[model samples]
Target: MHDPAPMPEVQNDEEVPLLGAQRLGFSAGSQRLIRDIDLTIRAGSRTVIMGANGSGKSLLLRLLHGLIPPTEGHVEWCERPLDTAARNEQAMVFQRPVMMRRSVAANLRFALSARGIRGAERAAREAEAIASARLEHLVNRPARVLSGGEQQRLAMARALACAPRLLFLDEPTASLDPASTHAIEQIIDQAHDDGVTIVLVTHDAGQARRMGQDLVFLDAGRIVETGPVAQVLDAPSSAAAQAWLGGRLYLDPTHSSQT
Candidate 1:
């Protein structure tokens, strides 16, 4: 992986879209998982993706983050093709974050080292990440031995330590306690305040309202609605979105849901 370039200074123009997908799609053999998705994510914006169990939320997030190749269409970063340099500027945290057998501090150091950060700069970043995630007490503990919440926190801190310009999280707070969830959200909030663009996938309506400025609702591999968080959650126009926000199950007659 190439060393990530320094994040560009935020321009005054918020209208310029930072990332985009044109007719994005993914499939497993004959089954189409994600259908044609056309979306734009503005720089420094907080966008949330919400959907039912098999609504292709996580798959879409993976496509946008370039973790897996799409079967069709393309993703763009800063008006250019999504390439290694663009991916270097992005990071992702999964629902169940994988941790090294090494200590918490070691895990963080490894990530920074991979980014070519070293010596005093690396030390500074490590210290900041430890503090930011409040992992000082557990720094010496084996990362894999930490509680679910601690491991998740470490995963988030490790990602942030690399100074990614775009952060993608897939149900980061799922299965975590309220307190732990709040802690993670606070860290995400801080990152956003520091000009990191956030793209999150979540099933929690409350979390969506708390962390999202823009909302995208997907169902049966297709986007049903896209709008401001409040507008979409409070007054969703699409039948699929309405059923989801209304706490009812929505099954698309035309498409089979992917699990």
Candidate 2:
């Protein structure tokens, strides 16, 4: 974890690719958003995607998770195609988290019940998730009535309830205060220790350094560089990545910062 290498040290686990996107591309009404990408995500490593606005980072993540079909190429999870059943082992948390109109505990229950869990087992799971996110006192409060930071924590707890083998985080801490962000970072570290493959899309350099060993750098709908975090952030191989990592490539700074 100290070295920011592109490929994590291979583990003793069996040969199984957690995620693979080959020659992936996406288009909408003659506008291509992402193009000709190939990526393979291994288990037990945190691979972060970093780039400027319109660099196709978010779009590429969605494609890899099988939320949207690629106009070209395909995605695979664990040797199988990225179908619904295959995707169930993975979970994603978006930048602006949306919660139900119900109580915080109710939201957790709904997520667990979706995976066919119910009753006392489900209630215990909800309590544990809330405590993990430091929201135990807010369990009975309405989800929507909570503060912005609280809502994001709930989104995180909900994602953890499923115990996914792979987790996709798209700016999960984008709108949070420092305390909230730090709390979620600890939770993610815990999840990583529990053997969940983590793919995070973020622009914060420090966050990248902490969580990312390998990096996926995208620009203008194409992957500009794919390698170790040190190479991509410290000594970026591509001009776009270098400028981005150095904080000098923004066309408009406001659009680039998550906050």
Candidate 3:
């Protein structure tokens, strides 16, 4: 696919919301998977979304990233409607990333190429991404043959290769070992330091605290609480937040409370 036409850059003011969703909702058949989510992602913030297994954390992420249209409301980027031009500035890494049937270096090349980069610039980005992900030794190996952690690292490298302004991750380290998880977090940290806005979804509380500046807690497809990571995790005021933090099963009052 060809790259979308370039969009004029937004000013670098940190206070400006880079992305926003107003009353966002998503439904499948008779069930509303996401409900009335009003969210703003600052230009240089690390926002983490956390919730139970069926709380719609992933769904919310998808909506915010414009991977799927919301059933109600809309998403905006840089105060404009979210469209192809806006989405071109974003990238997402999924739980089980799909690698192309090609070599590690080839995958990185493809990503940069897709962004309309070429020649020396593309080569530099490929090298930098490979080095950042510590995949230099495996550059010649087929991406699909790499281990789970290696593949995830490559996925991150591929996403970052495009130099996106916003990065979305959904359980990128859910099945990795501690070392792999740490590596992934380091990449995320580096990306944030480079002014890339981060929005991640993870069930690991410790990971949330380590990577998040702000937290969004979801319960029953709705936002229950949002605040600084420390406050939300330590002194959560909402019952849903409290229950999830305390290891108790959170039963949304609207649903059955009895087991």
TM-score of each: 0.93, 0.89, 0.92
Residues 1-259 of candidate 3: C-alpha lDDT, one tens digit per residue: 1122122122234788899888888988778888778888889888999988989999899898898999988999999999988998999999998999999999999999888999999999999999999999999999999999999999999999998999999999999999999999999999999989999999999999999988888877878778788888999877888888898997765643121
Look at candidate 1 and tell me the lDDT of residue 163. 96
The clash number for model 3 is 0
Cα error, candidate 1, residue 210 (Å)? 0.5
lDDT measured at residue 170 in model 1 versus the true structure, 0 to 100:
97
Candidate 2 lDDT at 228 equals: 72
Q: How accurate is candidate 3 locally (lDDT)?
A: 0.88
Tell me the alpha-carbon RMSD of every candidate: 6.9, 5.6, 7.5
Give a tens-digit lDDT track for model 1, residues 1-259: 1122122222224877888888889989878889778888888888999888988999999899898899989999998999988998999999999999899999999999998999999999999999999999999999999999999999999999999999999999998999999999999999999999999999999999999988888877877777788988998777888888788887766555443
* lDDT score of residue 200 within candidate 1: 95
Question: How far off is residue 122 in model 1, in Å?
Answer: 0.4
Minimum summed lDDT over a 10-residue window in model 1 is located at: 1-10
Residue 163, candidate 3: alpha-carbon lDDT:
89
Deviating ranges (above 4 Å) for candidate 3: 1-13, 255-259
Instruction: Give the clashing residue pairs of candidate 2, or none.
Output: 6-228
